[model samples]
Target: MKIIISEIPKEGLDVKLKEKVESENISSTVIAQLRIEKLEIEVIVSGDLAAEVKLECSRCLKDFNSKLMIPVNVVYHPVEELKGEDNYEVRHEELDMDFYSGEELNLSNLLKEQLMLNMPMKPLCADLCKGICPVCGKDLNIDKCTCTITKTDPRFEGLKKLLK
Candidate 1:
């Protein structure tokens, strides 16, 4: 889904897409409703990207699906601005800025990036997941394990005596 920069009309372009993204990060089909506006050489792409992402629980290690709707608000600058060796600092507004080369703006890549950014760093099936038992290797949520576990750091031995 590439939007040619030169072909954009003065009234802007509206695009509605439902396609599976070809990326390692995204596993499910994505639906995007985007409005592309051109202000001089800069392109502003704003829309909502909807997708169902398959995620694995960090604690229980169970696979689950999460539905996400990420709001797209990105300003694309010419790739030539990224050239030269001049040192620069990025401002707060520039956080949403991206660089594009040539007349094509790949919306698929944009959707992939937005989806990745919106995904959780650590996915959990539930907040109070019991997780798997460390010693007996049994799912604590499903079954109980009779494994006496004691963990006391050597440095905390003196502190244990004080509590007693």
Candidate 2:
């Protein structure tokens, strides 16, 4: 979804979209709403996006699907204005601001970015997942391994005698 700056009306534009995002981690159905406010010298894009994301459980390495909601709010300023401004350093308040060179704003890139941000750093299928057994490499969540495992390191064997 590309929008031309000149085509944006003075009252701003409200856009509703439901499209398939071609990504490995994101689902095909992506629902989003974009409120584009064309300011005097900048454009403000703010809305909400939601989708189902395919994720892998970090603990058990199992695949799972999770719902993700991402709030989109960003300001796009002209790149020319950024260059004309003093020493190139973004202030704390302008951290979310982005610079665009052309007259068209790419909505696909914005949706991709929001999806990326919504992904969990460490996805988990369950909070108390036992994970895989270290001894037999069996998945503990399915069945328990019969192996009696000792967690002590052999390198500390000499230290055990000292305690006696």
Q: List lDDT for all candidates, in order.
A: 0.84, 0.80
Over 24-103, each residue of candidate 2 has an lDDT whose tens digit, in order, gives: 65664678998998988788888898887778888789998788888888888888887666876654364368777789
**Once superposed on the true structure, which residue ranges of model 2 sit more than 4 Å away at CA?**
23-28, 88-95, 147-164
Deviation in Å, model 1, residue 107 alpha carbon:
0.5
Expressed as tens digits, the lDDT of each residue in 69-124 for candidate 1 is 88888988888877884874444384388879998999988988888888899888
lDDT of 2: 0.80
Candidate 2 residue pairs that clash: none
Error of 2 at 117 (Å): 2.4
Residue 101 shift from truth in candidate 1, angstroms: 0.6
Candidate 2 — worst ten consecutive residues by lDDT sum? 87-96
TM-score of 1: 0.80
lDDT at 9 for candidate 1?
A: 97
